[model samples]
Target: MDSVPLFALNDCDVMTTNGSKLGTLENITLNPNTGELKFLCVNPSSEESTEFPQMENGQVVVPVDSVETTREYLIVTAP
Candidate 1:
């Protein structure tokens, strides 16, 4: 794992493992008590994936555990 700053993820595109574009990184979710990552809030850029639940603020919530990589895009699991 590399030491990429969390701020680098801002506005980064998020994609599924199978190559489906979900959206852009809007925010991150974490466990306040432990400061552990929980999920990623993605602003809708495409309606190609619906495996994850969405938020009321129009951002799709993606589990951080499902993320495979974080480079130019946040690669996440399809389901």
Candidate 2:
């Protein structure tokens, strides 16, 4: 896997690589042993969110590998 530059995820917006707004990040799931980030739980902004994977609880779930973070957004790679 390629390295993702670390930054604060707090209150970050989620966007697609093509620049579509998904929503704000709600939470993150990680492995305690290896400190590996697994998934990102996000709040869907609108119907535009239907394009990505989501949890049964109605939250958008973005894989960490699909993320590219900036100071403003967690840029999600298109599948």
Candidate 3:
């Protein structure tokens, strides 16, 4: 797995590598034992959200491996 840079979750916007907006960073899931990040919880934007991954319980769980953080946004790749 590639090393994903640590980022401030609240400071970034979540989008796809293809440039589709998924939403804002809302929460993160972690592995309790290792304290490693597991997934990113995103709150989908009101419009064009259907283009994003299907939401479960009002949020999407983006796998950490698919995320790449830039200075401005969190780019998510397709699973």
TM-scores for every candidate against the unseen true structure: 0.85, 0.79, 0.77
Which digits, one per residue and each the tens of the lDDT, describe model 1 over residues 1-79?
2455787887889887778788888888789999888888999886654888987777899888787666688887857
Candidate 2: count of backbone clashes, pairs at least 3 residues apart or interchain: 0
1-66 in candidate 3: lDDT tens per residue? 245445555746898877878888888889999998888888886544443355557777788888
Best by TM-score: 1
In candidate 1, what residue range of length 10 has the lowest lDDT sum?
1-10
Q: Return the lDDT, model 1, position 21.
A: 83
Lowest summed-lDDT stretch of 10 residues in model 2?
1-10
After the best TM-score superposition of candidate 1, give how far the Cα of residue 11 lies from its true spot, in angstroms. 0.6
Cα lDDT computed for each candidate against the true fold: 0.80, 0.78, 0.74
Per-residue lDDT of 64 in model 3: 85
Writing each residue's lDDT as its tens digit, candidate 2 over 1-79 gives: 2454444666678988788888888888889999988988989888555666888878998888888767567788867
Candidate achieving the largest lDDT: 1
